[model samples]
Target chain A: MSKYTLREAMAIHASRQIRNEDKVIVGTGMPLVAAIIAKNCHAKDAVMLMEAGPFDSNPLALPSCVADPRGFVGAPWVADPVQMMGMILQQGRIDLGFLGGAQVDKYGNLNSTCLGTYKNANVRLPGSGGASDIGAMAKRNLIIIAHEARRLVEKVDYLTTPGWMLHPYENGKRVKDRLVHRKELGLWGGPEAVVTTMGIMKFEEETKVMYVSEYYADLGVTLEMIKENTGFAIDTSKADQVIPPTEDELYILRNVADPENIFI
Target chain B: MVSESKNSTKKTKIKTLQEAISQIPDGATILFGGWTVTRKPMAAVFEIIRQGKKDLHLVSNPGGPESDLLIGAGLVGISETNFIGHEVLGIPYCFRRAFEKGGLEKTGYLHDDWTVQTGALRILAGAMGIPFIPTKSLKGTEIIDPEHDLLADLRGKSKKLPNKKVEFIQDPFWDEGELLLIPAIKPDYCIIHVPMVGEEGTVRIHGGLFMDFYGALAAKKTIVTTEQITSEDYLKKQPDLNSIPAEFISDIVEVPYGGHPTAVQGMYDLDFEFFNRMVDSTKKEDTYVQWLQEWIKDLPDHDAYLEKLGVKKIFSLRADPGLGYNPRLKRKS
Candidate 1:
């Protein structure tokens, strides 16, 4: 019922979370959309690091698997994709990481590397580019996926990234001990929030459990709809606001992000 | 030298696009001037392919299928470019397959480095009569020396050849006794396609003049093929709109709608059917030759070439008819 497309809504919601001067690591696809939206809406100083080693510079619109000009055409500075991954992302210089997921679980783990299973799958997808580095080193991560039961699953076919997992340790002490690690370190780690067409959801920082926060305005869909689709619990009180893109936000999106087409 | 005089003094009537390409020699360094899908010199490129000029060193911005045609013909000995992937436009599968198969040789630079870093800066350097411009593009990157051996070799034996300091060291205090300045790329010839040109060779481009003037000014010779030819008075009417003045030009050939099979703005839209045909072909040398012969060689002249395109179809597709055909100029009427 929102005026924005599912992709546009996802971008609008993700854009709200980014601070004005945050250094974000952006990948291709939905990540590029979110970064462009953030830059146009609020994050003016958002530096876009492309895989082709250009910072915030737009190249001629050309089709490329990894180094598309759209990724950095409107960015402030461009850097080498490899150097960005190694020196910037891995070094934890990036504040927030925006990514897309093919499959997501209750724990917020995302699977984009494979389909069906790691070794054998019904289909194959483009394997991870810089997602691993961003997921590992970024202090905070936001994931965007279209709301559907098929995408929101109990378990992913393959574990492309380890979100939150149990850690074992041996020690001699009377006091109890619980050692926890974020997913990037090979231990189980999950995302902070997941934005979808139907509603928004966030994982409990302590429990690493996902709960629905808000529904899209007048989305005839209910908490039960999200619960049934996600196979998870719904948190209604946390759903304070579901913001739509403003006129200025929409203008920037149309002009800067998708000039030739209004699809996004 | 004799051929040069003959080409310069006497106006050689080249009947077809293929005839014009036979003039170029082997191993000639060429600078291609145009942005993506616009203002590209398709006629000259086609001619070069038809003549089968071998061991050519081509310099240009990233391109689509046309780049493949040269690589497919085994004419490109060396290519210095920013990017080579297929954009929304079809990929040059031959170029990709050739590179993957280790058949074609190339030296790659970052897209920004090729476009803004080396191209624009090199042009300014040439215009100012400077030797080179210092850039910070490839510093501390994998494209440095051993990783890009071909690029290093292109720099040659001059110790200052692959100067890294010129691009990096921002402060004089940080001088590590070294600097890397990208040498100006002075090509042997430059080729371009334009919307209009006067009999005196003044050129006008419509939108996005991406590094065309830079390539032309840096190169030794400049050749232009235009969609239409107008008079000097008409050209002088829009002096501010002119992209390159006739004084800088070395040769001017009036080949109206010469950008067939490739899109020429205002005159003709892209001949997608022809482009697709080229894409689907088996990509053998003989197949390409046969393909060119079928489309180009059989035509008698420019008028017949236009006739083959079908006047009805050209007019129907013409968003603006006035944009095409200036009879007074003796281009296509």
Candidate 2:
């Protein structure tokens, strides 16, 4: 049996989605680790961008934060928030983006703003810094968050960032009472996939509703276990056991990317 | 020396923290430059807290400790911008407490949120001396929903804020597509911390410019705090390095380690221990008060603040000459 933690598995699995030479915007935490590991492994040409201004940062080691001075070390060009956000991201130059939030709905709608209401909240989270823009503009995005019934809700408390949203899925038709698609809002894309502790979930191409695409059977995470942890009704027909983290990927994660276990 | 002689007639804007911050009136809209952890003007923020400046409207693209300190001290009444938490540090404890707890009740706090790109575009519009900017961001999201406009009643009533959060309309030129016309932000004061500033008020930023350049240009006036102060002649020797002109600055304060706990790229790295201390100290209302007393109230000046942290702790965070960050520093726990 291969030995690996769940977080390492999640990060390694998430890194596989990134393709070579794609420009990606990443924040802190697992997203950061995933991007670094992707660059250190197969996607060597993947460009990493940060809101704090590094366009393409290839760091010596995993920098502590996005604004870690290592971000500036190997960057080709540094930009302000306006240039990075407006000139690049909003203009749709970014290929992929990463987001994490307090709540992620079945449609991948994220709420990083607040819990109860805008005026008052049960739990007040950090409002959208760039999650909305990234969600709205990135051609494809990945969501990294802990898995729990409460977190994977049927409906988010606040729609801080847009995802593939639909209240009902009847007769394979998407448009009904009130329907909103990324294309309808002039947005290019929604979440491509959500990588969780259980496995990975991908949205249906037509309906844009999330489905369990893969599960970590080795970690004792079955379709029933994944479904039990989900708050919304989901389709498990397409679910399959995920590819386990390879020794090479795990080595790159431990030695090349995050040697100190900062993010892992 | 022709450039120096011609600029000599211009006023020198150097001032103490008190001198610069005291001039700021209550209830003025303010913007602090920096994204998350880099180049935050903590010195001015401390002085603002010490002076008990209240009713200020704080705006930043992605705020960190500078914004949190003000919010924690109950200084800001209205916060409009993209965010207010450290990117890696999870979230700002005080910003979280201010909303969940009754901390902001006294200030009648109001918060209106926007996305990152749109928010930065608003500031860019301000810098461009425009009234509004149109973008395709936040179209179907709740951000443009009329019901969520917290600044609804205060729209057009305030001098600084816009009449609405964002005006959604069909693209006038195309007339078929839709876009959002977000308002510009013109703050009364723009506070920034940079590594270098000339005695004659020429600003030079070595690393990422971040949002400081736009923030300075958009505000009515700017207060710059620097780690090193050089002569105009020295900085002018390398002209391409300079960003804002001398005329743009209203005041410049020389504070060597102005952005401690956070970071100022070329000079130092993030003091994670200190950051965790700030986060942990602000976990509870009582602990936060004690933290205020220990860090801000007890210390009268920047030197005292640095002394409290000690030279060892400060020096340990110094950036490696080549890497621009301390290579030996331990971040992972």
Candidate 3:
């Protein structure tokens, strides 16, 4: 790859998270771009779903929002929110879910509620639509966020999505010497990986603590730059330079995925 | 789902937009049916603001202009929603300013937030005529924390307000950790905008029925505004295509282009430029005030509002017959 925007890099890495046959639920913005790229470029059999109740939607053009009528163009059928949120998602069938929030912690917990207080909010944000539902119900979730010191906080202002917050349980007993885990609280799957504008971060196997896993060196986003900008201490010992997007990935991504230059 | 209109001799009522909205008094808890620029009853919303109903409670699902515009108008006292923002247009500036500039304590505005699935389950419970619904969502998150319950003050104060925020219980049957028992919410009215409605109250929603059907079924009364009103025989021929029975609807308003700025499928595309303009106006308090007055307050009715939008813009937004959305519409992204 000669050069790519930060968003394109994020999209490429985020697209890699999807498997061929994964039943994916994607929120709007870059995640939608990422899902489209994955469907066309890699995850051919993946089903693209959204909160506005479209299941297995295959759109020809980019929808302005998840519930935009355009997304229903090539779908099997349109559904109500009850069928989507209750029958499908709450039933725990979706495999891979994507979410984005205003702020996130090392535990992958997000806060999309408000900046200050709930009642007397300093800045009221759009609250967790399906971020919590997808986080708790989906088998695995991928979080995409902008990397900044204030946003990459030690603890989010409000916990909208349950992340690795408690220890895992063995036969209904909490395991000792372990960081927070979602399984202990009955959440289906927690954050698997966090793809940021800077790089990709993943949680440790045992501790569930987030650590830098990849970085974009060509964009001058080094491991040190990421660490310095982080609000909390982050591990970068096992970090590696990210493999640039392939020619095929780039072509499909630009032409098919986001022809409008929406996210990228 | 049981309803008062069930097996009743009374036919479903039909009224003008103003008259339908006029029946709803101040302080009524309402659920506006729409999500992210789709199927919002813009005509009813405008009328409510124009009528200046005060201290209203709102139930929302990933709200777009329906929720944000109401909050901007400063009519809503409490808004329970998972999300409130114009998706492509940007942040809900009015909603932000309402809370950020005017704190809940100071401004008398409370925001009770819910996760999307949990919100749906709550509404579903209402539609089912159940008091509460069980859910695995909001388990380990602060959404269910008692301290974050913004409506604590309103708890037990009014019939509409539930006594408790949420009751966490372990699965007694299978013993699968804690399950959140979310309270049911049957709003005073559910205003749903759709493409077609039968004379006897058969609703045919052309697009994604984002909680609108459940909302219609659950509410004490439902007002369905439509782009066109068809005959009962026309809808009954394809009963599967219709959304709900005649008993569920309280009234019908034949408001063409009622879901403007956020129209419906097979009828019109969302007015993205209008959303963009509204979002832009919200940046400044004065501009927002001016914009609201110009578009909502100053306008005599939905017809006038449509007139101000101009015939050219209206025709431009009409969805292509084959496609459910306007193909020629140029998007920002």
Candidate that scores best on TM-score = 2
Q: What's the candidate order when arranged by decreasing TM-score?
A: 2, 3, 1
Q: What is the lDDT of candidate 1?
A: 0.56
What tens-digit string does per-residue lDDT give for candidate 2 at B145-194?
A: 66677788899898778987776677767675767788998889999988
Model 3 Cα displacement at B245 (Å)? 1.6
Kindly list the per-residue Cα lDDT of model 3 for residues B132-169, writing each as its tens digit: 98887777677776666778877989688888878877
Residue pairs that clash (backbone atoms under 3 angstroms), model 3: A165-A180, A166-A180, A166-A181
**lDDT per residue (tens digit) for residues B1-333 in model 1:** 344432356443322445455567898877776543444676677667656688777666444445567766667766655434233345455554445333322423111113223444555555456777654333222222232234444454633233321232333655533233655666778887777877767888653455567667877777877777777679898799888987666677777666655545445554445565676562555776676676556654556667876876555434234432211221111
Model 1: residues >4 Å from true position, as ranges? A2-264, B1-20, B104-116, B151-180, B261-268, B271-277, B280-293, B296-305, B320-333
Per-residue lDDT for A118-181 in model 2, tens only?
6667788878888888898899999988778889988888888889873322232222378767
Chain A TM-scores in order:
0.81, 0.93, 0.92
Question: What CA RMSD would you report for each candidate?
Answer: 12.4, 3.2, 3.8
Cα error, candidate 2, residue B215 (Å): 0.7
- Could you give candidate 1's fraction of true interface contacts? 0.01
Q: TM-scores, in order shown?
A: 0.55, 0.95, 0.95
Fnat values, one per model, are 0.01, 0.70, 0.78
iRMS of each prediction: 14.6, 4.8, 3.8
In terms of lDDT, the poorest run of 10 residues in model 2 chain A is A166-175
